[model samples]
Target: MSKTVRIPRRSRAGILAAIILGICLLLLLTVGVLTVGAADAHPPRLVDNAGLLSQAEADSLRATLDQYSEELNFDIVVVTTNTLDGKTPRDYADDYFDYNGYGYGANRDGALFLRYINGSSKEVWLSTSGEGIKAIRDADIESIFDDMEDDIRANRYGAAFQIFAQDVRDEVLDYRSYDTIWIFVGLAVGLGVGLIATNAMRSSLKSVRQQRYAGSYIKGNSVNITEARDIFLYRTVSRVAKPKESSGGGSSTHTSSSGRSHGGGGRSM
Candidate 1:
């Protein structure tokens, strides 16, 4: 005979309570770690060192950048300065993005729009990283600058920054859409070539003539039909709209001062 040791009911309840508490604590710790990691992913997106924007305007622009960054899963930043610290527009923008830790993901996926105001001369540079390099092409960067050119000239800093943020979001989201347009264009060209070849083959067949009725296929008095009926079958029609032209040329990249590859363009205002 063997005697079995049983755990008391209160002890079992206490053990269950402790396990539940431990799980809750573990979940809290995990959430906290994730929060900290997210915060470290990208630094402050808007740095108006030149004081180009008012307090209210800065807040608004920052909010817009934050919103777009979250939606695109890529950092969008704006920086303004009175001087570039003796570096060229491109070098300054690239260095700012790299040294300030202002990007997301391992590859530092982000875009930094830098406005360097020196006296009356204004220069802007767009610096792209990781996925931003592919999403924003040279032509796309030019278009973005065009969109902000008028606003910036008019001293509408807030409006210009908003446009920059919106355009960046649009370009990133529609980057693959440009490729789709090319696919459509290729399909249309192939279809046209196919039709032309088929027409040429048909034209070469001189022995085949157009027949007005089914009776032309049968020999004279060889077959007679007692009754004839026409039945309707389903018909399918497919239509593809023509693809609109896209202005996306392609991304051009260069090695930044940090040895990291980047793609972008610059404009003078």
Candidate 2:
């Protein structure tokens, strides 16, 4: 008799290949999504307009300039500074910057640089990136001028400061909220890809195990019947019961013993 052989399952390399393949598929899908991906970030960058400062803000500065110029022949240049220089402006329509002086659609910290086009010999320059006028006030444009005047009169720059701390503070706040959202989205994508790889590897490993014992193993829902023996059932021929008859003139009789018996081939007496 021919013996039945067990089927061999797949190997580790095979399973590893499957998992790697699944990961590659996921990465390909990610690439496709990127081609058409929408915003999935914090503070919900889902809108077309993000991080855009208000027109009123620029106008307010303009108003301040106009107020400052109330009967003078000077020009007020209100350029929205590019503080973070983030990839996109915070808003749909805002100031921009080019090779020349700052233009519309540019995003930057709140700042106001002031100088006399043709007036003060004692020039006052003010620039800030504050959230509001309160923050602007903290930069103390008025005080800086006052101090500069005093220092010049005394022939000493004891009040000299080339940079302002308030601009950094303002820019940090604006970019902080947006940058965090971008980071969160990136992390989520990476995590999802990892989970897909893990599950695919587990599935491929199970497939390999099943291939190892395909012919002999009776795979139940969750468990495999590995140790079951193959049984060949045979049957000993059953004997037929014989009929009994009285001691008469024309009758035959027989008795059954163990597994042997007589049949109806005998003739009557």
lDDT of each: 0.91, 0.36
Best model per TM-score: 1
TM-score, structure 1 vs. true: 0.65
lDDT of 2 at 53: 29
Clashing pairs for model 1 are none
Question: What lDDT, from 0 to 1, does candidate 2 have?
Answer: 0.36
Q: In model 1, what lDDT does residue 107 have?
A: 91
TM-score: model 2 vs. ground truth: 0.20
Residue 118 alpha-carbon offset, candidate 2, angstroms? 12
The digit string of per-residue lDDT tens for model 1 on 58-122 reads 99999999998987789999999998888999999999999998777899999999999988778
What are the runs in model 2 whose C-alpha is more than 4 Å off?
1-9, 12-109, 112-124, 128-130, 148-159, 166-269
